[model samples]
Target: MPRETPMDQPLISPAQRAVADAFERMFELSRAQPAPDLAARLDRLSRLRALVQDNESRFEAAISADFGHRSQVETAIAETLFVLVEIKHATKHLKKWMAPRRVATALQFMPAKNRLIPQPLGVVGIISPWNYPLQLTLAPAIGALAAGNRVMIKPSELVPRFSALLQELIAAKFDAGEITVTGIEDEIAKSFASLPFDHLIFTGSTRIGRLVAEAAGRNLTPLTLELGGKSPVIIDRSADLDEAAARVAYAKLLNAGQTCIAPDYVLLPEGKVQEFADKLDGRMRGMYGTNPDNSDYTSIVSDRHYARLEALAADAAAKGAKIVQLAKPDDPAWKAKRKFPPTLVVGATPDMTIMQEEIFGPLLPIVGCKDAGEALSWINRHDRPLALYWFGKDAAARDEVLARTVSGGVTINDCLFHFTQVNQPMGGIGASGTGAYHGEWGFNNLSKLKPVFYRSPFNRLADLYPPYGTKIARLQKMLRFMS
Candidate 1:
């Protein structure tokens, strides 16, 4: 090859350039207007509400198209409704959340008041996953906007149709610098995390979360990783078998078990495994039906995910565990539609593949434990989960689990309900993920709560200032007396 000039070399891909331009534009605007007033923030929230409300039907259709077939009811309940609720909560409390609060000063600093002021962090970047695209993407944006910060979102490439629609909608509602959504290009995904955002929030698997964290670390960008792990459901002895089975079945089957907080496995009293498994299978079938074309059922995101779930089932089956699938896995109808059957892996052990990883599908493993202590030990032995569910009437057993093991959050008798509480924080701990955001927790996390102290000129504390004389001796004596 002949020697090439610097002009011959491509500096950046088109995707990277586009992302950089967007970031720089928003960063500049944020710098120019550091704090947005309550009215301005309210306007942004209102537009966001209008955007989703006006085109609910269109968004539902686009998301369904993207997923091959996402349930319309599920989309409405989980995605759009969740975002609207977050927006409503933030709007109602925006004025109060924006106000500076008074802080008490120490006795020595009397007449000097301290105030904690909440101000916007410049630019916030959100990297949302495809599982619940709309909710995960816009919920964080609501908080950042409520906190008066500019936002840029990078939606998952897996749902291109939905992502494109979201980008178009956002662009139409607000300026690119005010709130923007980027394309789902490979180059953009790689470079998006490298941008030095004032704060970045990522929602996805632990494997990808590590890479994102590494890239963000290079820019020292503060991150909130909403990652998933093998969260467990503990069926206490006092739990009503029928009630527990129904709740677990609904939770694990919703969105076809693509939820981050979905119950990955179950730990019930030893002898009750087979009975609970049977009940769970019945419940799953009753809710979604047996056919692949059931309207209430959701399809897997892709062929690869479908095959992975199959492999997990196969591995568990080959290792002496029994597989109870709601629909025949080999049926052409199921595979053709990309809908993996809801499965139960009974007699699952730690060595089984299904038990080793976070099954982001409809496959749920049921493992038996001797007692409550063994159940707690089993959970504590693994990585801390993002959410834990304990079903029972025994307060002691529930309290024991709560006090012993550490997880992101817990639901006493159900699943995923803790995440719906607007006042409670939603986040993970340890390997599951880190940091939290939801309602006020989100507002405070995304905002800079600066502490301001006003010094009083009238204070005579200066009397102890530099003159080493009888005054210093008197001060020493006074200090000794106080001590």
Candidate 2:
């Protein structure tokens, strides 16, 4: 017989306590032992790689279950393969990244040498969203581990199936003190954010990011927020309509437009709105087909999310925007399966609700601008976006957009490709997000690069330290002249 637990005690405390215990153990170990050496870090990376490779099918299945019907190919490309690339990149570069860097000494301190040494922050906490659960959660963990910090993750409750599968798989490969995933209970998330982690990384909407920032702030925890905003696409007169339309349509429709960096709206020449919309509609239909049951298309995550997308379309319609649904949105088959039809809102104005918020679903609005200058002004007026896409052939026009606007990242003549570059840092600016992490940027972000200086015994710098003599005044005069 088992002893009964107290009914009045918080039911979620056990789950929260388990996470807290894991953090404590990891933190203590980080303090006691020197950061894991190169070989140990490599071993961890190898295990992580094997964990995904061996369980790829299961992960795809679980994520599909979470999304009602997530495309298997999308999972492979976006989630699993992406993580593998990150791990491989980090493994290949870890030694050079770990080595201390030489710093130039000042002329006055020429005899002394300076070095910047990278060391781990004790433990890192990751709060990941559901849209790309595996990729977002593990990408930062890869960076933290490469930098020699222990990791703890709290995945979104919306993807409970994937979250549970991740928790089990990670535990099998890693020690609790090395890396661990926590439960997705409401209380656990509340408790998880409040932990005094050495650093925190959150990927989600800006609204929730504020709450996480507030919690992390109380503990003075440094944070990397990967929040989303209304990322825009500019279609210049020089761009080929058919080519641009196909690329943008594919990008916008991927995972039902759940991606943070997906183009929120398109700005094209004033008169071409309808022409471009027809081209986009054709491309979207060609790729995903008219049936919502197409395996290539993914379902919206839940009924609530489905309804939200519908309301956005309806709201835009009410505001005099023409709503173009690729398939019938009211079809019982689509709604029963939680699939949201690909939609375009034409003649979208600034006053409409669709243009006001980050449209996280498969709804896109096409707004027209008088010229490149007007397009630039429109983007600058809002919160900086996480990503921007420009479609055109004119070098001067593209350069103008690049020079005038601010965004987390940009891709020319395409969408979502800049983020795939391992050499580039992935992050956002302003409300879109703050801080970047990818490849070496990630290793550097999670590290404490302490500067050390070696002093020469024969140097006369000590003579000017305390005594207010004539010699000190002469030295100070020379320093001022150098400054």
Candidate 3:
């Protein structure tokens, strides 16, 4: 028997109730209007693009305020421009994606045509995270809108200013029945998850993903969870050390290493650990300077997250890990700004807290491996990550790693570039996440590829319809033989 969600119990506030009512109204409106033409979808996408473009400075400031010191360049590239690119991609290819695909009719059903129609899933719920709040929220919304479905977005409560601003922007550009944005506290988030949306998308931690999965499960709602794990970077012997270090440093330090697909740890060639660490340190220092306050580095999102990251580093150091701070550790100004310097943790073990969890901060653990096989074995030993980055020129080694490891996505000789490709699907496999969304994949995921069959007026199945007789048995035998 299925467990029931108690409806009589009031788990949400009046404001949350209003949001829920809005969702119900939007869902009904989506059903009544059913399929939206390409022109309507394009118009929605255009409005969304205009919304981001018009409020670029506001978005930058809001995100910067939320993060304490997020660089405008980073916001433009990662958040605003990223979404704009997605909109452009969707707009350019929506017609092809929406076209009904013809399927071959089997011999058993000769003369009957079959086609798969990509239809909207009515109402979709998007629950975005705070790390890249604007991009995460709007990217999926782009897909949902392109697929002609109504959307209700729940921005993370962690970034209150950004969430409020996003709500205002979305409300101004779209009708509530078409696209709506709301911010909810923890209790309301639970209620929001429990709603019977046609599809739900969540981007956040693996732990919370489990709860979201459970709630969505009760309603049998399909979900696309963009959860995070300890994404690993493998440094092959044939790799360029300096180049690898620079790419890894940029990815790990971007958004203060708070990115979901950021290289959580590096598996370096055993004997070259120090050399690789040195190159990485140089890259970090060059990128952000010796003083974190003097650079375009971002701070941790909140004091709680800051304390948690500090605790993880402290726990690892206490457990015999060699901590190497790349920048000046005792800088009072950097400390005051809550800007943690990029650090490298040597001698990380499986039992250490830093190794056990996703290090969504400026700490990179360097694990030594003798060869490519050892590195592959180490990655296989843990849950699949959101991404796996391999930096080397060896074709065989790269292909071997690709064949052996399972992850949401991968980038060769670079980090996080796989995510930038609009054609490819970005998502996880086992634990990191479920389903995928990006490009046409995102549109398809939000839509139901409903199979349609056009039966001919000249029917041939009447002989096998009702009578359980010798003729029917013979027909079945002949069909089985043909099959």
Query: Deviation in angstroms for 106 in model 1?
Result: 0.9
TM-score of each: 0.96, 0.96, 0.96
Off by over 4 Å in 2: 1-12
Window of ten residues with lowest summed lDDT in model 3: 2-11
Q: List model 3 lDDT by residue over 1-483, tens digit each.
A: 743333434645876677778877887797687599999999999999999999999999999888888978889899999999999999999999999999998877777899999999999999999999999999999999999999999889889899999989988999889999876677678788888889999999999999999998988999999999999999999999999999999999999999999999999788999999989988988898876666478888887887787788889899998888865334677666778889999878888999999999999999999888889999999999999999898899899999999999999999999999999998998789999999999999999999999987665766677766877888888799888
Q: Quantify how close model 2 is to the true structure by its C-alpha RMSD in Å.
A: 4.1
Query: What is model 3's C-alpha RMSD?
Result: 2.2
Stretches of candidate 1 exceeding 4 Å from the true structure: 1-11, 468-483
Q: Which ten residues in a row have the lowest lDDT in candidate 2?
A: 2-11
At residue 389, what lDDT does model 3 achieve? 96
| Candidate 1 lDDT by residue in tens digits, 1-483 | 752322243437877777787787788788887599999999999999999999999999998998899999999999999999999999999899989999998756567899999999999999999999999999999999999999999999999999999999998999888999999888889878888899999999999999999999977889999999999999999999999999999999999999999999999998999999999999998998889999889999998898999999999999999999877777899999999899999999989988889999999999898888999899989999999999999998889999999999999899999999999999999888999999999999999999999889875567688876788787677667766
Candidate 1 TM-score, C-alpha based = 0.96
Order of the predicted models by TM-score, top scorer first: 2, 1, 3
